[model samples]
Target: MDFYQADPTLENYWRGVILFGRNVASYKFALAHALYEVDKSGSDLVTLEELAVPFSRHLCQHLLHAPKQITSRGSQFLDTCVQFNNGELTQDTLTETTIRLGFNNVIDAFHNVNAGEIEKRFFLDERKTHKGIRITDNFYQLSERQQYQNLAFETNARWNLVEQAWAMGVSRNLVAIEFDEQEKLLFSHVNTRRVNITSCRDSLNGYQKGRCFYCFKPISLVPADTELADVDHFIPWKARDEVANINGVWNLVLSCQCCNRGKAGKSSHLPSRKLLQRLHIRNEYFIQSKLPLHETIVNQTGTQPAQRIDFLESNWARAKNNILFHIWEPKAEGEATF
Candidate 1:
């Protein structure tokens, strides 16, 4: 079935794959023990090529269906496996070899069960745009230009201030906005203004509408709850300082705490040629015309206008796919077995 059309139960299966993949280090040690036994019996070398299938099946069955809590050792082994198989882990030690083998097993297993086919199913219809344009293009075009850069920077700075103000409210404390000698706000004071924490949470919640843009998890904020969901910079803030980078609403997204944490400060979005092509944001004129107004509506209302979501989702999905493929290369490396 197409990944998007997969039953929720089947969806959970993929989640299990990701979670298991992340913890492949633990599986590596176990596989190592098995390999040692096989080798000790005067058998041939049990490389990844020899053991991929059974090991993958073993992991899928034991790791996913079993109810036992994963031990720390197991977690480490699985993590190592994923890193090694994806070539992110170096082969300086026996542990690394085992981990790489375990990862190979997982990839083999995923293929055996047609996991890749499922993912392709969901992404099959994802559209492609221009190859030259991207988040940086939009940011530079908007910021370097005479008309909009200052406005963009000022707007982002303002939001930074607003975010701090909202944080104070969550802490149930008063705070003051700190300003430089020139009267420009630098930071917020401790325990000064009675921040409208509810309003701030409401604003972010409304923007996300409860769904994490990346993981698709629901992200709701309870009234008076201190832990607010994070607002992610679709393109990280550190990448540039232009007004377009600061003010573009298309650059913001609602993310669950976990996915947001994973994506923090990551600038390289994807490595695959096809995926990169999809992420390129060509048509500078379109970006210039649309991004500033999108920012204005978001800043004023703390929510995106509906019309913008359609365009933004398409653009964001391409960018997100690029990042996911880069970071989760193991998930993308193997071919579908079926």
Candidate 2:
């Protein structure tokens, strides 16, 4: 699926960075939040010190909840942020440390996805000539959009999901994750208690490129909207007992109300083989993101791509054999989007 050509909007490019960009650590998200902060001030040219304030602030705020921000060990910048959070470091020291160590990678990698820079350059790296980044017109246009506020919410939501997955160390254990259909959220069990991680719709909308999983239509992120997105189980959650880890993020996709539970919506039905293939592709997006979802899916399915496809196919065959389900394809079809 062409990520840009499917939507080809400023928001789509921004979503590509937030939702699909590689994150060994969450520096991309912090830089993204800081960009939004400075974008509000209408400042085209933001010095390193000006950028470090919100950049360090967001990291500090997230660190209060999640102790581990990076996948690997030992980040001097994160250590400084932690010290600041623990009242051991001054604000000036934190800002200076952030300016020195924080932007080393994230500034150049902010617009990157799948190891390539996105067509829309949100900000230009100006550290060589000027000790700061220059906000591009694309970013200003994004900020001026009506749904700009929601983009920030979506970014935070994605960040929460990734960090929570990392913090839980899903690779080590077979996580006991439960989905609340009522709240449309995912909860992970820790020490016999469940903790809410993030909203399903907000976390998933970007992967789907803000389109319905089945019909490829725009799904609303606004709560008050009539067509707010629905978190649909790609393999049908009703078969949870029969299928292992059926409610995992691998099986979840964001759908519009009409395609989810309308007159022709898919309910307790097997999706078509094409949709099954699409599910594989969608799962690849999660895998490439390297979020905890990747580990969880690999734990449930398989590590190798072929093995993963075999897992999906095997499940589909089993579900088709036992349950009497009419194969479901969206009545209102649109272009294919992963």
Candidate 3:
């Protein structure tokens, strides 16, 4: 769609990574959560405080969706934040109380000063002169919060920032350009599992009868050295997540080493229609077992099986909208003839 040539502020403002309404992803959910940090006193202008809210949240909570957290950016940051706290909560696996203690440091990372702006790193350098400006804009040549302006809506004839954050949609081609290499790594790592991917090996193997998720190749339930049962994020973790845990069992699947290697980090990839159907059936099996995962799916979507299917279909709508006819896997490698 030549996203590079399109207007950054207006053209695709309504299209980026939206999380809540229909095609919402966790990344978009992070952005929406940030909009709530704004001050509501009369003025519609955004402040540095508001801008930092989303950045901090993304930096701290991105991997919360994943099954394990040992290697996540938020995990590392949280550990650093609490290295000094002396208590029983630090016994192993931090308690929620320990996590809450670091809340102050997270917010403090975004300084409250005109001199240094940390939030600007995630925004486009280019400015939109027409629609005011965001406090996060450059101190020298400033840009508008135009990227987020479109998300705004009037309540009692006044624009509400929080509401806009919730309703703002995302572009199919949206990319995070502001974060540099080290920071990028902090926000993302596909090989990064929330917990050991192997933890799901037994559960998924039993569910699929020891067949790979995409290829349906026979996998050894007890492969020596765990080579045959490579845990895969059904939706590649690299595609949309900015270093959060995309390793949830809902997204995780057992795959043959070949298929997992071929599908390496293709973030934009979506499963083919056939695979999507397979996934639906597999999930139904999980539900029938009445396991904890079934409850997890319901908690995630707040709906029954019928609505859950609808959500996945809708998520794929944007996922498949890439310029390449099929950015999904098997574009180069031959898919299994299931």
Number of backbone collisions per candidate: 22, 0, 15
What's the TM-score of every candidate structure?
0.25, 0.84, 0.36
Better of 2 and 3 by TM-score: 2
Badly placed stretches (over 4 Å) of model 2 are 1-9, 88-93, 114-116, 144-150, 168-178, 190-195
Please write out the lDDT profile of model 2 over residues 146-227, one tens digit for every residue.
Answer: 5575687788888898778777776766554457788888777787878898887887777777778999877778888887
Q: Write the per-residue lDDT of candidate 3 for residues 49-121, one digit (tens) a residue.
A: 3344443444244333332222223554345324423232342334333333423332332221222332223
For candidate 1, the lDDT comes to 0.34
Give the candidate number with the greatest TM-score.
2
Please provide, for model 1 over 152-249, each residue's C-alpha lDDT reduced to its tens digit, 9 standing for 90 to 100. Answer: 22222223333343334423443332222122123334445432211222333322223454444555554333334565555445433322332233
- State candidate 2's TM-score: 0.84
Candidate structures ordered by lDDT, highest first: 2, 3, 1
Residue 113 displacement (Å), model 3: 64
Which of 1 and 3 is the better model by TM-score? Answer: 3
lDDT, candidates in the order shown: 0.34, 0.82, 0.39
